[model samples]
Target: MLELDLTARLGNFALEAKFSCETTGIVALFGRSGAGKTSVVNMLAGLTRPHRGRIAVNGTVLFDSARGIDLPPERRRLGYVFQEGRLFPHMSVRRNLSYGYTRIPAAERSIGFEHVTDLLGLADLLGRRPGDLSGGEKQRVALGRALLANPRLLLMDEPLAALDQPRKEEVLPFIERLRDTLALPIVYVSHSMAEIVRLADTLVLLSEGRVEAVGTIEDLTSRLDLRPLTGRYEAGAVIRAEVVGQDEAFGLTELRFAGGGLWVPRVEAPIGTELRIRVRARDVALARERPRGVSILNMVPCRVEDIGAEAGPQVDLRLNAGGAALWARITRRSLAKLQIVPGARVYALIKAVAIDRTSLGRGAGRFLAGPAEGNLEE
Candidate 1:
């Protein structure tokens, strides 16, 4: 487990956060710019000292101000991947990765050069210098360099923040592999909701130098306070589903969620692929019955679980579709006119255009293939 209870003052900003997690996968620090994410990371890396409190990772104490015990950044055994690749412009990618490995005593190195290369898909680019590599390639090299150090924990501060959409996409799968394949824990910092939903297994929400909330992505996303942070365009619940099959003639892929099967835009994934999908709240429409003439391809029978207060002009409705949870943001008048209430059986209508194609992943496909069981309450 990773734990932190620290306070620090920087110019006009003050950070006082206390949270702990047993996350073995990626733990994301999410918030807007100037939300103390960088500061917290710096403290964890021992680059900055907190005025008070303790920091520990798996029973090893990194800092304890009361006892005046603090380890230096290099001694913290953390692998940090910064926004910039920070690769040696004159050195080949191979050399950069080897440089860190060489610093450690040969007997102490847990990860070997070949293992790093294969894990990062860097075999083809080893001979290339940073100048000759694309942004994604350079970042991979940077990640490889960190991995060779055999860090107990990995700290990535918006490593994809500087990249274009394509570059970000290129690096994401590698990051996912890092989480799934390795035992090392990760503290990833990002303001993007899409990244959090796609990558994080646990979340620590920070705002203006303070922690707002910390929990699983589903738990935090369902909270009203966090809705505004996600922005209306991206506000939604992430669902894990399975790929049952493909409809070749219609150019569509069929996904099975809690209540029923959903046909979405064609996705280039194999059968039995597991995927993650984000269904935006605004894209969901509630129906009292199965409509006959609607063009929507995805409609699942669900019951209203609860309703959140009207924020701005819309009210957020939490619905339980079989065992999976789905959220919809509708006008207050609509909720009243439709007489929507808890336990009311309804159909969740989702347009194909509203589903984010990029957020779809293999993990979701596997979930859809399995029989729906247990409640996935948000």
Candidate 2:
């Protein structure tokens, strides 16, 4: 368990946060730029001292102002990956990785050098220096170095912010593997909705040095209050599904969710893969019935769970598809015309182009096979 109740004053700005969680998985501290995310992380890392409150990780007291039990960053056994790769430019990748291992006594080293290298796909670039690597490669090396230290907790502050779209894609899978395969707990800070949707198991939302909301992705997305902070276009629900099959002829892949099968653009994944799909509220349309002879390929029958009012002529609808949930944003006029209400059964009409490709991850096929079999049932 990780618990924190900290307060800090930086000139005119003040940061106060109090939150706790049970799992050791990735906990994303999410918010826009200058929202006190970095401030909180720095305090937890012992880089900055908080004026009051305590911080404990798995019963270990890292900071306690009242008790005066603050520990230095080095002794805290925490690994930090910054926005830019801070590797030694003069050293080779192998040398940089070895530097961490050399610090730990051989008997105390829990993670091996070769293991870190293989996990981050750094085996091929061991001879290369930081200067010779791309943005993604350098970040991978930095991650490898951090893991090799076998820290109790990891801190990532917008690790992908410095990279372009393609470069970000290159490093995401490795981070996923680390989260799923390794036992290390991660505190990842990011402002990108895509990163939070794809990577976070738990979310800690902050606004101007204060904790706004903290919970699972589903819980946070469903809250009407958090919607305004997420921005209009980025508001949506994340659904888990499996890949059942593919249609090579039409270049379409079949994904099975709780409510039914969703045929999106062709996915480059194997059969029986698990996937996390983000269906934006703006991209979903509510239909009164299962309309036929339409170009829209994805439609799922759902029950209206809740409705939320938005600024400037729109309302958001929360729909339950089988056991999973989806969000739909429609104009006030359209909602009134359709007479959509809570408990109303309707089909969510989704256009093919609305599905964003970059949000799809490596395990897109996993979700298609597991739940797809029963999702087609009426």
Candidate 3:
């Protein structure tokens, strides 16, 4: 487990972040700029000291003002991947990775050079210098170097921020592989909702210099109270789905969840691959009855769980589809006309195209085929 209840002062800004989460997968520190995302990670890294409170990971106390225990950065044995790849200019890719691996004693080393290079897909780039590598390649090398250190925790400070869209995509799959293959805990820092949705298992929302909420990405993203920070335009529900089958004829892949099956654009993964997807609230519309003879592919029955406070022209909605939560953003006029309220049963109309490929993500681990459900529309 990772825990922190620290207070620090930096000039005019005062931060009092207090939250604890599991170390199973990626725990993202998410917020806008100047929201202390970096500050919280810095303190955990021992680069910045907290004035009061304690910090611990997996029961090991990293810092404690009361006990006067503050471990140095190196002594903490944590791996950190910075925003920019800080590779040695003169060193080749092989040596750059070895620089950290060689420092750790053979007995303490949990990961080997060969394992890291292969896992990161850096075997072919071993002879290239830092200057010759692309943005994604450089970052992959950085990840390898850090892993060789055998860190108890991995801290990534927007590792993909410097790369463009294509470059980011190039490196995202490798990171997913790393998370699934390794057992190490990670604290990822980023302001991008897309990145967070694609990776994080738990989320720590920071606002200004404080933590607004801490929970699973699925729970927090569906919350109406956190819409202002989650971005009204991007606000929606996240669902865990399994690839049931592919319709090569229509260039679509069907995914089955607890609620029902949703057909999305063709996904290359084979049957049974579990993927997480976001359905934007704006893309969802409410209907009194299931409409037919229409182009919309998904029309699932749902019960209204809650409604949000009116905001000018639009208001957010919380829906329960089977056991899963689905959110929708509808205009106030529609709410008045439709008479949608808590416990009201309605149909949630979702367009197949609204769930884009960019938001699709594979859950960490081996992809297993799920039990065959009867109908694709069910």
TM-score to native of every candidate shown: 0.87, 0.89, 0.91
For candidate 2, the TM-score is 0.89
Candidate 2, poorest ten consecutive residues by summed lDDT: 365-374
Across residues 89-201, which tens digit of lDDT does each residue of candidate 2 receive? Answer: 88999998887778888987988987787677788899998999999999999999988888889999999999999999788877877876788899999999888887877
lDDT value, candidate 2, whole model: 0.84
Name the top lDDT candidate.
Answer: 3
Candidates sorted on lDDT, descending: 3, 2, 1
Q: All models: lDDT?
A: 0.82, 0.84, 0.87
Looking at candidate 2, what is the lDDT of residue 286?
86
Of models 1 and 3, which has the larger lDDT?
A: 3
lDDT of 1 by residue, 138-223 (tens): 89999999999988899999999989999987888778766666788999999888887777778898887888888987778766
Q: How are the candidates ranked when ordered by TM-score, highest leading?
A: 3, 2, 1
- RMSD (Å) of each candidate, 1 decimal: 6.0, 5.7, 5.4
